[model samples]
Target: MYIINFIVSIIAIIIGINIRRNKRNYLIIGYNKLDEKERQLYNEGKPLTTASNIFIISGILLIIGGILAMRSPVPNYLTIVSWGVFILFIFGGTLYINAEYR
Candidate 1:
């Protein structure tokens, strides 16, 4: 369970790095669907940077939470909650970014 968290965290961090480097806009949902004009209306840099930061931060939080959960005496619910919150945060953040950029 904790191992799964670590693995997902690593993948998220890698994706964040790629997004920050502007090498993987296609990985962004709905990014590739925009035509050139719509793309122009959408400011690319700020939203991508923000989303990347969100991903990186969430990934770090997952790692830290996983470690804490492993060391704590609590059951696996802590990890489950952490993962749930992470997913919601990512989803909400992505929606916010898309709406704001659009």
Candidate 2:
């Protein structure tokens, strides 16, 4: 269990770093693809704002959960955190699909 937690923590850290590094690019691509009014609204904070917020929140939670799992017997928390990340992934995919189609 400890080893499992350690592996999960390392994976989470790597994932977090990669996602954070690319976030600006993601924002740029998403922003540029929007119409002027949509871009303005995104800049002002609306639906698009949630994307980064959710990603960051889920990433942080995953890291924390991974750490906690590594430190204790409660490794199941990492599973929950992983599920949250999965949900965010789905949400992001849906957003991309909607944007691409419309």
Candidate 3:
């Protein structure tokens, strides 16, 4: 079960990385053609285009979290860090999804 959790967490990290990559790609492409509303959002830094940044950061956090959660000989503090990373991963995902749908 513990191994499974670790694997799942790693998978989440990979997904996050992909998301972040897509967002960056869109950003680099100048966002194609932005609607007026999208332009407004971009001006306000809300840029509802892609969740790449969030995903990338979340993926990194998950990697740390997974390392901590693994049954390795790491210290207690690492375990805490792992949990923290997992939390960030969740937050990133939530924020991305919310922004995308909204």
- Please provide, for model 3 over 1-102, each residue's C-alpha lDDT reduced to its tens digit, 9 standing for 90 to 100: 344445656675565566444544343224456666765555333432235555455556655655555656764556567666667666665665455544
What is candidate 1's lDDT per residue for 1-102, written digit by digit as tens? Answer: 899999999998998998999656676679899899887887778888988998998899899889989988984988988898899889998888877878
- Measured with C-alpha atoms, the lDDT of residue 57 in candidate 1 is 87
- Candidate 3's TM-score reads 0.40
Q: Rate the local accuracy (lDDT) of all candidates.
A: 0.86, 0.53, 0.53
Off by over 4 Å in 1: none
Residue 56 in candidate 2 has what lDDT?
51
How well does candidate 3 score on lDDT at residue 35? Answer: 68
Task: Give all candidate RMSDs, comma-separated.
Answer: 1.3, 6.1, 7.0
State, as a TM-score between 0 and 1, how close model 1 is to the true structure: 0.90
Q: Quick one: best TM-score, which candidate?
A: 1
Between prediction 1 and prediction 3, which has the larger TM-score? 1
Clashes found in each candidate (C-alpha, N, C closer than 3 A): 0, 0, 2
Candidates by lDDT, descending order: 1, 2, 3
TM-score of each: 0.90, 0.40, 0.40
Clash list (residue pairs), candidate 3: 20-52, 65-82
